[model samples]
Target: MCWFSGLIALSMLVGMSSPSSAQSTAEPAKGRWTSLFNGKNLDGWVMKLKGSDLGENYKDTFRVEDGVIRVSYDKYEKFNGEFGHLFFHQPFSKYKLRIEYRFVGEQCPGGPGWAYRNSGVMIHSQKPETMSKDQEFPVSIEVQFLGGAERGTRPTGNVCTPGTHIVMDGKLITQHCNDSKSPTLRGDQWVTIEVEAHGNGTIKHFVNGELVIQYEKPQLDPDDRDAAKLLKANNGEKALSGGYIALQAETAPVEFRKIEIMPLDD
Candidate 1:
């Protein structure tokens, strides 16, 4: 069987809950549950990056309309500047974060490449303000979300880490991680992604009831180029780890619904 298929089977065995079910359990539950996105506006969120343009010009790039926090590139004719990241106000060491997202519209101009249509949910990221003035993108583990242009591609809830590294099976798995399986869903379908982050740096990425990737100790790999750059910019490599979380607005348009968080007590 394929790696992704095996991951799906593993997710089933773990009894992971969907976003809807998890949200349902939030009310009057045994533990504390918090809503990351206010749904009406970007209340508890902050945007920061390298350059003077902290975000996508604060336009419709990251905004809330109706009840959803949408990451749209409708205003941009193209993605010019460096990288852009939208982060939550609170910093999390360990927690279960659940988000619903879907890609929309066509690719923007000056996007990355074919992969530019890609966007990500960054976890275990550094402080937004601490980033360099010329920094492009973030040095965090990206819970990559992808859609298929063709039928039967790969499933959603893929994983990709940039300028980050984690431990898996006692081995150091540095930055640059991707799903072996192609996306299976296409068009504008809302897919659910749930992540369980253990404070010690262990994390699991799940999509639509399937576990796509597992990682631990999210920190700069020390071997990656960006990690090296960030190290130089920050004056050290230890500057990473235990920061905040952010969402990507690469060149594609995407929307996030039900962005909620439940802190896990270690």
Candidate 2:
């Protein structure tokens, strides 16, 4: 070929292989991390407390103040096992959820002893409207959070299955709760917790950037009353892939500053 012709062909090849050209033609990745809690108000959230109707914020239990969403009971004279949940409006399939929380003051009087400094975020949860008027907890997977006591070792970032179960290490786990190896954060210290859920496949837990727990195959329990109805609607396919996210108000004062999620699917 002539030198001029060869040079022109090489220039065209270089142009085609340029980064800008490839980027313009490539399919873009989908999804982005977004703030679930507005940090200003509960604009996209609903409330459901045990023994009360849906949307009832018993004694104003859930509120937003100082750029934080708080589960407070200072106005109540007692704690009566009024298990409450503040649920996000949307449901998700595959995502990473992160939140920052801390225990404040003391557990309310009459609160369960086991509930001291205990609160959690429920994922893959049943809809609020489906829960009975007296249901304590919805069918979900709980990323259980427990503040450290002044005395002994109390782990945080544990897993608590309510009306559901998971498989770990290829074994079908039937335990109600599985403790993580994470260190206990005593007192009123801010702690960051994160969960990576891959639909009905695998789920993981991390605290302060350290991986503490991992499991797989989360499914609804047929024996659970609340979950039984869901099981039927799901065509008896126990695999739980998607559901709502809710924050717990289990007779304790807790504050959450950040609640965000990053979608995994396009």
Candidate 3:
């Protein structure tokens, strides 16, 4: 090739590889945070409610509106312990999930009093298809979210295990719920929460960047009827290393504005 033509091609190639140009077109790294909720529709999520078939969105309970995922029961006469969940399509073994949510409106009629303004994000959860027709919750580690009460402190970022167990402070925890050291968030104010799940390793919860709760070794409960079936499927494997993510619809109305995750492994 002529010297002038070679020089022109080299310059064009260099321009295409320039930092500014690359930055504009480059995709995020494999471990970078990604949005789970697209803010406009439920394209990659599945809904499951107790006593209902998979993908059954009873009473339009889970919907995307106004650029957020809203868990509402405006069409229901009573909650009736529907206990719904919206599961993400993909499953992950190690990652950090961040979400911004706010409790809004009021609990549905006949909803449990203790579940007022309460919902959760379940990690390392059993698949939605594995749940019993009447299962209230899946076998997983719940990063519980709760709004403050009228007269007392109602801490958020707590941990709840349903049909599962965890070890905290090196001791096996058999309790249903474990409280965190986070301060109460009152009213309909938005709260940013983060959960870091490291497969079968330790998991940590953070409220507005403050680490509040930490636990380890989430495993299936052989005594739980539904979890026992899961155990049998895995040849009695108890340690939950990888599973789908799900958002709870536990009677109260809540709005999740953002749901994002950053994978830690391939």
Candidate 4:
């Protein structure tokens, strides 16, 4: 009888210890993965810049369907109007942003004179409410995603700082330029782009798991009008410490999927 009682107590003790043991031994979840898109609706996204209304009325430019956020030109008869931007609701200072995008369909009329059929992912972006009604686009660092038809057919990850500048290897790369090597996968295939942004103003751009571009301390050029505006809005600072993230709607139809972000702590 004593043996039976001992066994019962031992079983209960072992059962109780099981959860605590698992709690202590279980591995931690890998990297902080967060879904930027809800896959059901644009819950944490906002539309800004030249559509109609103050972003709420530009339904044709940005829309969600079939678990993807698509930037389309179906509603635009011509792309003569101002450019458009779709910004995430939250601001992230340092993190890895991974996005999958593919180009589809033809360019519309008045579409950037043949050089603007492409779209981009704008990082370190300023608030949209701070700009004037006639503002074409935000003054932010643009990770320019180009298609095959762009000027040099450089289907790679490039940089275009509208109201921003960056220091690379002790010199200033103030102008719009492609990366030293093209990191783009050509054709209509979907490409996975990853950007690792360090809070200290350093960033790395990756394409299909390969590092393509790296830079640090992006500031605004003194002579550029957009840079000046950004500086003024942010208390005369040349570079943004951190800001919002946006997807562009140029003149062509583009589709985005698997848009995810993971926050990193220093």
**lDDT, candidate 1, at 208:** 79
Q: Which residue runs of candidate 1 sit more than 4 Å off their true CA positions?
A: 1-30, 53-59, 180-183, 224-241
lDDT of each: 0.64, 0.82, 0.81, 0.67
- What candidate 4 gets wrong by more than 4 Å, as runs, is 1-30, 114-117, 150-152
For model 3, how many clashes? 0
Tens-place lDDT digits, model 4, residues 110-191: 8865454478899877665554566777767788787775335465677778866787887888666656355445567888
* Model 4 TM-score on a 0 to 1 scale: 0.82
Return the TM-score for each candidate structure. 0.77, 0.87, 0.88, 0.82
Which candidate would rank higher by TM-score, 2 or 3? 3
RMSD (CA, Å), each prediction: 10.0, 14.6, 12.9, 15.2
Ranking by lDDT: 2, 3, 4, 1
Candidate 2 local Cα displacement, residue 131, angstroms: 0.8
Model 2 TM-score (2 dp) = 0.87
Clashing residue pairs found in predicted model 4: 165-219
lDDT of 3 by residue, 42-108 (tens): 8778888998988888999999899999999899997788999988866667889999999999899
Ranking, TM-score, top scorer first? 3, 2, 4, 1
